[model samples]
Target chain A: MPLGLNSPQIVLLGVNHNTAPVEVRERLSLSGSNTPALRLFAELPSCEEVVFLSTCNRVEVLVSTNRLDEIRESITKLWLDRGKMDSNTLQGALYEYHGTSAIRHLFRVASSLDSMVVGEPQILGQLKDAYRMASEAKTAGLVLNRLLHKAFSVAKRIRTETRIASHAVSISYAAVELAKKIFGDLTGKNGMLIGAGEMAELAAQHLIAGGADKLVVANRTLSRAVELSRSLGGSAISLEEVGDALVDADIVISSTGAPGIILSKDQVKRIMRPRRHRLLFFIDIAVPRDIDPKVNDIDNVYLYDIDDLKGVIEFNKAEREKEASKADRMVEAEVIKFMAWMESLNVVPVIQHLQEKAEAVRQKEILRSHKVIESLNDEQQKAMDVLTRSIVQKILHDPIVYIKKGAQKKNSEMILDAACSLFGIDGLEDTQKLQDKCLSDANQDKTIRKPSPN
Target chain B: MHKFLFQITVFIYFVSTVGFLVHIITLRKDAERIATVVLSVGFGFHTAAVLMRWFVGGHPPLVNLHDSLSFLAWAMVGSFLLFQWRCKLKSLGAFVIPFAMIIMTASSFQSKEILPLPPVLKSIWLPIHAIICLFADAVFALAFCIAIMYLLQERQIKKKRLGAVFQRLPSLETLDAMNERCLTVGFPLLTLGIVTGSIWAEKAWGSYWSWDPKETWSLITWFIYAALFHQRLTVGWRGRKAAIMTIIGFAVLVFTFLGVSLLLSGAHSYATWLK
Candidate 1:
């Protein structure tokens, strides 16, 4: 028979970027004003605590409840009714994890290992926000509070030990990285943007952050260039003066949609002779190739098109994937440790039952013997009571050690069931209430050492 | 006794080579530390064997194929270790230690008997010329390793086929900078070696510029690196072009050191020292 404590199990139901489309996810996403959702979850049968996490890519509900079936059905119905989505269409889109698997999932999500980018740092902040909202709404209790704190520590550990977030994984980031490769140091260098387009402006911002001493934005329209440059604390120049401007600029970022080549080999070659000491890096992130390809042949010139930036992003993605596996191992280890702690907790109630049953039998035998031996002195009766208690204690020692040791190992449920049967323990559902009381008492004694509700 | 020490050194180097290769494949940080330790042990043994040979033979041990190969391996390991200390480039040991192992293995196949020094070689310039030339070759070997790594990193970045191997290697910027450093330091040492050798040549052979194949190839190697330096200083060839140029220069240098002595007939065809 299964060990019966009627304790609440952790249940997690979610839809992430991989499982649901943006439209479906948005329909389920809860805002900070999620009092309605919180009230609905709190009213669910047997739900002791709940936390709802909603972000652009995912919407998750984590709950601790004994009636898993009732909570799952109620939450599914509530989500479907709110979204007005057909159950058939969204049937296989939702994922549900329970017990240890649920806890592991929470840790992975908090650490950003389950993110779309694998290593983005935004998920931790979003998780913290979800936790805070749950706290304010009175939906989170002792169980979830502890779980969330543990998840935060796990996330912090993974971030400290891995290079998952160290590399650039975006197109704009790749452009900056390439500039660094050429110049060694971006400080004390001049960065010039050839067009006032969004991509050029983004690259200009990255260059400025990289410590470029000067920024020059050049465009066909002088007013647009000036407006963009002024906002970034840089100067603007007309496109006609770009050739002369190239003499001082160390890095050039071009993303104009013009049909013709903006910079040619002869133009760059002519400029290189006058500025022979400086290296020229051309980031041509344009469709029709703003900078001429032949210009790459010119001395001291390095040109990278959009395709090159894509390569850098791909490489960085692969690197993050490698680090993800290391994070996975860490998550697995933490899950095992948490499971062991839970198992030890489940055995606590069984141990209490066994000891209490033995004490009741010993007390009855002692009181009966005291009446039969009323001729003896009160001191003699007390000595007999002490003697029986010592005998019972000596008999209980080996069994207690055996059960506690078994609880630390795997498959601790079988050991707990055996102890309950051997002791003739009954009414476990009633004992669950006692277990809950004792858990709160233990938590009061030491918050981190509380019995697992499982 | 020295031969036994040389064998042990070779075995240690082989183990270190495996260690570094595993570090590259697995990306285990502990493997890097272990490999460096093993390589240092091998270097210590190799140094002991070389010193023993020098003392017993009453020379610098530059008399035969075996001695020259052993000396080259020693120099390669020494320079690579020095670079590792300065740069902490663990991935680089994957390339350099294995190259040293191959040279040591080749040296093991040659006869271990020490041959008598030639009467013509009995001069103060002998040690000076050989030591300086070997030091130049060792520095070039490091440059070659960095150049190859630069090309590999550049290829992965360009082709977009990055895997675990790509991540284990150093960044393209780091490899490029290290290559440039090799040139800045190595070129002067090479120029000094050639100048000292030419001076020794005039004293010994009554000529400063013999058209010997080794001397001619050495000049060609020098010119290749000179061209590299010129382009690097004047035009600032930064990434891929610079890497490819250094690779080409390394090829000519290898040919000058090995091919000219072993394949061609010349006064400096010193491979017959064993015979």
Candidate 2:
């Protein structure tokens, strides 16, 4: 693809969960502390700036370079060597986006629209970590710096303006959300997990992560309960002890394989006095439902079977999908704005250089006539300064407007090159110098103005 | 002048009520903050109005229905501000400020003319009795709002239909704890108010035990709260039971404050003096 002479071409190449299986992702994933990989990407001859992001779901290399083909070949070779995979095997798994599409992809990723679960928040943190790593490795320069920061703000805007991440989308998370609604903060609240079912264990884990004070594992088999308790950093109790545990436990996840209800409304009612009628939440994920549905009848006691949790997850997932479309539109608008800024980066330096060249000529003429001007009064000298400055501004105004307007169109580089050659401005070297200066100035402004990341 | 200040205070409270209602719908922190600031300013104006009434009337402003209702609204705002400071329950104001606004609006419609102090109300016990009782009423009013919130939140959780109110209301435990706090504070005040009322009654009426309609209703209100307070401490009667009892207790307290005077005639009938 033909590109502007000074525009930094952004290219993104990656394999995410949708593109590759876990096995391939695992092989290609870089550890958080992988500064070496970032350094290698930055040191590539064709890569002007680089940021390497490797999460559990994706391994993406974002580079700003003119020689895209060379960088793509080198990045592919390095990825293949690291993953021990052949080109043909990885060919179908790899995906690439160039220029504006690359930027849109980055923005979508930061906003979590490209997440495996669509609205999960971990990707933004992972992206931030990658950006931080690149900064520390001196791999991300002017272009990547601005791009990543823009991505962060775009993510924040989407989060605040859209409800994409506001709902629980998984069964275990839904259970925890309901518990929070009932009990508010989970701090100091005790949880009891009955049976060793995978779903029950996962719910227990979520409760503990939500700040539940303690966990008690109860199972028909004492050894299994002990092993699960050991892994979960909680105590173990036999199935017979589950009744006694009810008084102390505030949240209970019961998933026993029993044919009959293990916890009944009458049994919970009997324990209510001892429990002080504190809120009780029971998540019964068993096929037949380990806790009787009638237990929900007890005041301050809430029961949700697997189907109920699935209902919540489905409702929330639908809500999130609705919000995700809104977020996608917001991301699209932000991408356009950012791409405009990127396009301006190409023309901004040329405009500045044109102004500088005219000022230089004007100043040289003024100095050449300095002896003649010494006879003039101070007011006349001030007038001479203003006169020469405005003359230079008027002479360069149309060309500057033409270049900026051209930057907004597809044939911007042609207009920019024509303007440069007509003005006798060196097309390549001076543009590079001025672009570097402009980028540094922008970087300084960003450092001063950036809000502290939340 | 004091009446004008009171009107301005009511207007400011109305504005704050709107602010809080908007805050509830938008869930904006800045809206809450602005509403709280507006409410505080109104509270200041309210304080000045009450003090001006006290100064101009040459007595504590708790004699007639208008004065007592104004005092009641003032005390409610005071209690709410205190709880808001301590608990930071953001949506509590959304429930509470509107109630205060209604009380102030009701007070506005009542006769604001200051009457000559009644001989029966002319004693040290008048201020002590009326102030303590009305302050207790204010605290119970707060508990009433919290109970409503608790019920709404509990219903949302029980029905498994978490809605906007569920998200805004605090946890069941927090509301219950606040209820218990109000009970602990308001119960003692009620007891003291009754004690002072009887002592004032003995001094003024030549007898301490009269089954006057207001006095009898006050006793009944006391009994309900005492029972709830007793059960809460001893048998741990709380959550739904406590919330329901609080609502019932507040209802009876309101009746003792207003219903007896308007609906029934007795020595405690301040409505007779209004005419």
Candidate 3:
């Protein structure tokens, strides 16, 4: 069946880390458990399907609608009303991608290429959750089903082929990486978090995730330290016991807000003496680093300050950016595949029309021959039917193949024109006015492949 | 015929070296495959040349400096290909294969005549000692190359100016692993080489403890590597420091292998320049 000029068009409009600040994004964000995707589907007139993706970094609404610009405006207004903000205030925060670019954007998002920390694995899971929500709400139809599944495969390919997600791109992650470089593995290793601050806690989380089982949280405030330790399921220690903790710690992350140094070079040297120069990694992410800078001069004591961690993160970011170019090529190749499939959709209707016209003519001729032959029995009738059907199929075979190949190349205009004129099919050329619909759809599509059939 | 084959091997190594160099420069994908295949063919011909020399002379060709140099180059190429296959580190070729080319080029300048083997060189332990030492040397050469790459990558990471070379090179973790792997394999072979050479020395010279310059320098190189491995095991000396120490150890070993025999007189001084 040939889709008319009103085939479902893809429209994407939302706020991302790049397009909006966290404050603005939070105002418009949808919770995963209670997404208003189905409500959004009901609210919009022309929208056929909707999938809303809301994460800590981005909030995107992907919809299939025949009215692209109208739905885009409606979505922007929806965000403004939902945010309770003025139009001008929320105007620049929302970015829109339509048709194929919208799909490419979705692919990039699912692959984590569009993430704040590119190649972080969480976005794929988050996208999957959003997809599941849309599926449950029945707001995702055939177009979205194919697009999302294709996106998942693209994400998987990007993850496997490139080292985008293999390296750490955050300060806490860099601390874990340095620990690996020092200890080779963190299993059963001891880690100390000095200060129980947010940064210290984050580093501690990364360490635990990387298999450092033994953790000690130390801070000047004993109660806060104890609280943090209880939350993280680790033992708590007072700031005074940091030296004692340092002796057993293979990885130490200190992010205390204190102005002076927490561990002096002499204290570190003393700790080293007992351990006989065991490796101790210190990540001082505080503004004024907790550990003395000279502590790095001590044997087996590796100290990396915030700036050093930043350097690691920056290097990793550059590496991911390089990998993104490779991902871009893969996405481009996939888009070509998808566009070819879509162009093949155009050929489907023409093939159906040509088949219909041929069948109609075959039926009319058989009836006329049946009336002229009075002695034709049932056996002879069966043979004549087969003979006529085989001739029609043979005549239609070459033209069908030629039309399909031309359609896949998107050179369907000349071939469709020639085929329609040769076959004397009437409604298709008038439906060529409906080519305006296909033309507009193709315009919204990046690889339009034609100007006009007329 | 053997000499002609040897020359062709050297020529092929030169071409392979150029191909790898272009791979690093252009970042072309097929260059590594082409270069590796070419280098393997060269290694095959070099092997043929060695076997032909062995059959014609009625002995293994480890008699003099000329023969030893060619053998060392052949060992380096063979081990390089082996490691390259094992690790899939084609970029390492850009750093290591040049040593084989340089050794073969230097070998070409030396005497090619099949001289009579000295009575001292006739011991079976001579070939064993030489083979183990050359194998160890080949591994150390790869370690040196990886160490160089590690330092370059580390500098780029530290300076926060990751550019073309940094992208072409492997990660710090990968380079460090290669260095560690080489040390793990090379150190034991070096121990065996030293042990075999000492037994041979005891038989030939009546004393195994003579501190000839080559013997003294080889011990020095051995101790340097030993200390490097010890620090890595106990104190976790790795990354930039580890890389730097490997490079230093390679330099000392090169001096022990070539400089001692060429520039300093020793009981094992058979590798003097051709005259």
Which candidate has the highest lDDT of all? 2
Candidates in order, TM-scores: namely 0.81, 0.81, 0.81
Best by DockQ: 2
lDDT of 2 by residue, A48-77 (tens): 999989888888899998675476688888
Write one digit per residue (lDDT tens) for candidate 3, span A183-211.
65688889888888897888888888889
TM-score of chain B for predicted candidate 1: 0.96
Better DockQ candidate (1, 2): 2
RMSD to the hidden true structure, all candidates:
6.7, 7.5, 5.5
What fraction of the true Cα-Cα contacts (under 8 Å, chains A to B) does candidate 1 also have? 0.18
Candidate 1 chain A weakest ten by summed lDDT: A445-454
Q: Give the per-residue lDDT of model 1 (tens digit) for A35-127.
A: 556677777776789998988988889998766557677888877876678886455678777777788889999999889898999999999
Clashing pairs in 1: none
Question: Candidate 1 vs candidate 3: which has greater lDDT?
Answer: 1
Backbone clash count for every predicted candidate, in the order shown? 0, 0, 0
Clashing pairs in 2: none
lDDT (Cα atoms) of all candidates against the true structure: 0.80, 0.85, 0.80
